[model samples]
Target: MRIINPNLENKLKKFGSDTAHICFNCGTCAAICPLFETSFPRKFMRYIQIGAEDKIMDEKLELFKCLHCGLCTSSCPKGADPGEVMLGLKRFVLDKLRRNQDV
Candidate 1:
């Protein structure tokens, strides 16, 4: 039961995730990742494309797990730059947490 907010992609642009929507979920990023055995980068990319903000927040810790090895970025045929998007997500999550605490 996930609710999609079409504006999430636009909102993420401020945090440096401008190309998330360009990804077509081809799983190349995940295949190239040397870290987690799971979907890793691809899963996060998909979440952003579909505006699954709640899911992204729930798995926010996973963002920190990215190694920024460049493999995922280079392997992506769409030039989506999943590594950069992951970094953006880290910034976005931290900002949200800070804002929540300020309230």
Candidate 2:
């Protein structure tokens, strides 16, 4: 799922390639989100798209807190899905981390 959507970039141009500034931080996502009040999709989305690799790495625990429930997707007017993307990063990083730990 590392495949970046080609049109999605332009589609989300103002939004950014990954995070998309399109995130209004309206809290609709956070409000409807079911993450036990531990989720912050708006900020998370910004960090992901900006290639904030260091920040994302540091915030790994917060990212993993995401349940990827897709409620955010349902309400997102921009169609920007922060939940699944966060999950993807979690999966990718965990897989790599686990592989290294195995050695």
Candidate 3:
């Protein structure tokens, strides 16, 4: 069961990509992603926008599939910078994992 945390966007900003909440789910990022047939950055972006923190953690491995070629960032009409968001998510997930290990 995924619990939604309304502050997820704010939490994500610390990792980087302060524009994480700017995405409007246009799917342009997914359309241009060369690494996966399924939606890549858009999926992550939506999770962030909706404050789906649990969902993000659950699907964290999918974040690594990003090639970070800048195509998604360049194609985003909203200037959401999906590539930057993905990088931020990687850092966020890593931090969460580290904190969990230390607990």
Identify the candidate with maximal lDDT. Answer: 1
Clashes per candidate, residues 3 or more apart or on different chains: 0, 3, 0
lDDT of 2 by residue, 1-50 (tens): 23333343243333223545556556677777777474476666665545
lDDT of 1 by residue, 30-87 (tens): 8779995589899988888788998988888878888878899989999999999999
Q: How close is candidate 3 to the true structure, as a TM-score?
A: 0.92
Cα lDDT listed for each candidate: 0.88, 0.61, 0.85
Error of 2 at 27 (Å): 4.4
In Å, residue 67's CA in model 1 sits off its true spot by 1.5
Q: Give the residue spans of candidate 1 off by over 4 A.
A: none
Error of 1 at 42 (Å): 0.4
Evaluate candidate 1 by giving its C-alpha RMSD to the native, one decimal.
Answer: 1.9
RMSD of each: 1.9, 7.4, 1.8
TM-scores of the candidates are 0.91, 0.63, 0.92
